[model samples]
Target: MARTASLSGFPEWLPQERVVEQHVLDTLRRVFELHGFGSIETRAVETVGQLLRKGEIDKEVYGLSRLQDDDDSAAKSDPNALALHFDLTVPFARYVVENAGYLAFPFRRYQMQKVWRGERPQEGRAREFTQADIDVVGDGELPFRYDVEIVLVIAEALSALPIPEFRLRVNNRKLSEGFYRGIGLEDTAGVLRSIDKLEKIGAEKVAELLRTELGATQEQAEAALKLATIQTTDTSFVEQVRALGVEHPLLEEGLTELEQVVAAASSRAPGKVVADLSIARGLDYYTGTVVETVLVGHEQLGSICSGGRYESLASKGSKTFPGVGLSIGVTRLVSRILSQEFATASRSVPTAVLVTLNDEDSWSAAQDVAAQLRARGISTEVAAKADKFGKQIKFADRRGIPFVWFTDAEGAHQVKDIRSGEQVAADPAVWTPAEEDLRPQVIARVAAEV
Candidate 1:
């Protein structure tokens, strides 16, 4: 047998991880649907040109080709091959443009899909990652109300997760851009790129790089760095900066908007959001209301959610299509949560009740029990193997099946809860398991002594 090397950048999770992943996805879909965001999926391919125009030159984009083109290398380079979609937004923009004529105005759509990136894979960053995105776009112009709605919806979605504490630190691109311009910084993009590395490279290193690499003046570099590092718990941070005599109208306006967003977001999702000036989301396309959510103690996981408003991103002309959005990196969040034991599965199998198939002759009784229980909204599966009672119980226990139904000539079913080692004989139509046992009770069970 030949050995195969583990593919780089592509990661597959264990069974437990898969359970966590599904949980995260299910929660995201529920929130997205609750807020009227319909689901749409785009193919995992785009032209190299569209991807390049999207941004980030260094991103590793794996080109596609048919095996037929393997012989002719030039054939692989033909225009027919499509690049994997980098993020949901770019492909979504192209989707809206193509579907504009038939689609309704103010298109609110939520997408859950994997995106490929040609970057170094470490920790949260991966060659392939899953992102749960919700974006609102109109035919030509996007409304400001949708911007707040997008941010607010994402915050609510994340709050549903089992994380201890997190803050959705949001800032407007206009505020940052206007501040950059008013403070006499010529290259706002360049300054933002440096500020984005504030977490990675630290403030001192970022300031030095800004001055040396970006040709920023010492004072300008320091001010920008301070803004990137500056964080506040509430709108009070706005007044804190104002007291600094920042003396920039754009900065003042940014502070004002921050105040409004905090008040508004807090009114709805109180204490779930905050205004942090340092949230310079290191992206070129983001034009306003940048956001980066951070879990209190696990700030090391970095921003679990991030995105911002972009102006005229989908148009051929400069007609503003200003919209704001944030993506919950499901893969990243799930990985951290599972790795850190943040969420525990209730059961291994999706089934709550297991019906034992005693034998081929009596299998009908077990099948009948399954049908009756299922009709009652109980997830019951007939044991594929008609093994002994001990073996059947072992199978259920191994998979963390909470309740097992045992049939007898009494023409009835009995229920057993695995955890407490309790068994009760009753009618399959009337008996009920606790809420924890109703669904897949997946979790890491404590190891028994050998």
Candidate 2:
């Protein structure tokens, strides 16, 4: 019974669909908390300057203005001009800076909230969606181990959800920039922007862009393409890059760091992480490791999760806060889950038992039974009308309520499992439904099918 979306990019789920989404959110929260990431929420709106300062997402930002305000009140050039935040990272960086005094060093936090964009809606793309982000920001200096940790944590979180197999394609910005520089490509960022499209476009197209747009020679462009194509699940990528004969001090440093990440992940989360050098992220802020995740067979849907290390994203006058993080596109995942029937809720409603009224005069008795059942921690509701027992059972069945309660004329109580038609005398004070029946179950469709 989900309603069609009135607006193209905004998604609205029915009660049952929402239950599945809630299960995803709850599972993510539990895993994140178990890893020691505290939850926090940032404001939905940030200044235009703030939103645009970190990433090249100005075109995606939705400006904020009150109806009563003048047309010129929300100027993009104005530092105070307000717009909805496009992602959690920028606002979180700002938050860390403003509250640096109150926050402990290397603050680990997770935020799940709606973010807005002005993209053309398509499968896995939307104007507004919920994102779940986990970040660990440090004071002045963040260790490289966190970069590796972020991948493992994300792997664990995604594994816990009822989703298909995914691979975290990871790369290091330093490694990319260093190799590009070693090959005499001065416009490292420009080359990265082109390489980021290697998946969408082909290798030839990306190399052509590198030469035409960045003024690189055919040899340099080919080298860049070769580097981008080097991908492996372990540290073998290090030798592959070295075979290209590219050498720079920064390049060596990047190789070491990236090798460390891949080496750690090979043991901790084998087959889950890959050294994908083409993952440029196309953002100017990501200074070190970057990651992009894709479901095994759904690469066309794009990355369901992405983030990286930002060494200079947040800074006070004297100190800088470097952080590593990843964000899960919760809405996009849920959309695919629902569309593909990946999982479903057992019931649309939470009521476990429906207390039926035997007659118009038995309404008070039904209420008493419902209250007693509720007091015992059962989700029980009284029937709205004194309909026939058949009609009452139909109502409960429609809502997926498994049990129905009946009060006899002699004050005896009995409960019937609508699913099984098994009726048994019971006491409202002590009767308890099976633990699994007390709440709606989020059953994985794959497992159910198996």
Candidate 3:
């Protein structure tokens, strides 16, 4: 017999779990809008060529085809085959190019949507997940200050979420590449790719790859490892790099630019952003600042947010669009929150009060009461059955609805706080639950502990 089972990478949450996810998405949206970011959602499917523009993510792209079309026929008919977008950045670049005639320059936008990747699924990684992204795109020559602003905006967004304290690890690709060249390594991009695997393949393995694959000597590999290990919470990292005795004009420029970002971030959001020289974002387009954020004490989950500046990712007919962006891994964040029980919703449903039916004939009266409560901006639900007072109360209790409303022979109404068994006279037309109890609330478990 055929059996049914859930696909491993596609996650589905229970009602309360979904409540927490919604609260997170709402919080991110509120913060993005508060910072004057307009919202736009790009198409879910992009041409396979468009998705592979960056060249590194070809393996992760999920190609699409009509069920009726065979491979040879489809390839001949449609030269530009479609595929689900692997990341929001590429699609946004395409969007900027396609609509350049209409949009204002230096456009700021926030996008929250699901993305697919045909990759192995791990604890915090999923094949189908949601990412919340914010980007500032310029017509040409985007200022260095916007890079710092991107860090500030992301710091604020992360701070507002109900998660453990986080550290935004900042780095400059110019610094890394220039440092490699200063150390007599000709292949800076090759060196970066090897160093990017330092975390996964261990220091010793990475050293071997550098020497064997990139034709680097033992000293060059050691120096690269040293560069990656240099991390500081303040601008002192600049002096530390100066002490390294490697000098290049690009290195000096990157150091100055990174110092400015770290200084601004420290003054605005102290201790939130750190200068970690080792953060080499593997993407080829990240020409300037790169960042990866990890939750405190949960380092195993990997970076929950990451992005950088792409100086020339979006270009249209001789005009270059330099953009800086940050993306929050929504699914990974929600998964960590749920798996660790870091936060929970007050109730599964939004109903704050259940209007109980006293008898079979009183159903209409309860409905009226519920209607009045709902009209007044209160989340109220009428009981499904007029079986017994105990049964009606039980129904509300099962749903975690705090209040149970009842009517008397004289048409007087009283609502009971099921938790405390406190019944008080109420006017359905004007009565309201306590502000805190009005709707489903997302409560941080840590706050309750405190």
Candidate 4:
């Protein structure tokens, strides 16, 4: 108890900063609900076996253990048998399988929750963070159309947020894996893991890894890199990949699928989406379309939103629930907004008007005045002490409260605009601030700068 310290990866926001965060969460929820996605919340911890079902994230999983369990009992139960979930999708997949018998087919759910990871933290990547995710699952066969629709849903969601302009770079695992196969390479997964590091480790090093680790020949590595470089805002990427002279049945199928996604998304979201060949998504289960979004000028922040299609993410008996999902890195996005001043709350606190106390004797009357304003849906706060008029005004100013209410000797109320120093007589029952002044509004810095 004597030791006090701070954790590096856990992020906490200040009041004004939280205003922006809450607005982002609200905006995401509103848009998801409008799209007919039902809200769901899952438990924080999942069985360790469930967490490691995918296998690639073993190092990042934080195992849980109980402190008071007897040694013998603890030994019988796997020491690291339970752990916090690393992502929403895994836990959700398990949930669907467990509840499939009672749930409807083509179930659409949106989940906003905190997920924990024990990975090294950096800008935009944290040990603990909030993710806003949406997924559509189907009983037997999930339409490929959901893959296209998922990105469009994300594009619409991002358009409504206060973040900078962004581009959703999409690719399909089948497209990449099929291409690798057509090129006579058996280690498609290894080649993919190598190419996924294109941005991180650069082409030369990645080429070396492909040749050394995957035993890919010189021509195969070059061809893989060539495919990775073929990016287009339209469906032209289909021709670009076809022109590679590598032919396989899976390759053709993947090309047709990707073309349809890019075409459908282009007609809907226009320039917001592109068929970027480099997006491998790293995860092994992404069977179809994969997406990764980058803020136009802030690519260093990495993917602010990402997810993909998993053909067998959830299953029960002979039935498999295929799904497509996307997650918005809420903490990562909001942190950049606050750090770069990309957006800001109009006020530090929710209270828009501070009702000044005329005197200690008028406390009851002051409380009544605040009650009336609040009843009318206005954010009002009553002063705790009857300080000097000048000091009370300063109190309102310090908290960015736009208006200050003062009562005359006879209890006649007057409201003053702290910003403009304009005072006007007003009725406590009917008076309201401007529509925009009722609650804190998050303003984008680019617009504010203008």
What are the lDDT figures for the candidates, one per model? 0.75, 0.91, 0.89, 0.88
Considering lDDT, which of the candidate structures 1 and 3 is the better prediction for this target? 3
Candidate 2 lDDT at 295 equals 90
Write candidate 4's Cα lDDT for 342-365 as tens digits: 888888798988999878988889
Every model's Cα RMSD, please?
A: 4.6, 1.8, 2.9, 3.1
> Cα deviation in Å at residue 261, candidate 3?
1.1
TM-score for every candidate vs. truth? 0.88, 0.97, 0.95, 0.94
- The clash count for each model shown is 11, 0, 0, 0
Worst 10 residues of 2 by lDDT: 441-450
Global CA lDDT computed for model 1: 0.75
Q: Between the candidate structures 2 and 3, which one is better when assessed by lDDT?
A: 2
lDDT of 1 at 278: 72
- Regarding TM-score, does 1 or 4 come out ahead? 4
User: Could you tell me how far off, in angstroms, the CA of residue 291 lies in candidate 3 after the best superposition?
Assistant: 0.3
Per-residue CA lDDT of model 1 for 171-212, tens digit only, reads 876677676776788787887877778778788898898889
Residues 255-296, candidate 2, lDDT per residue (tens digit)?
A: 999999899889988898999998999779999899999998
Off by over 4 Å in 2: 1-3, 72-74, 447-450
* Model 3: lowest-lDDT 10 consecutive positions: 1-10
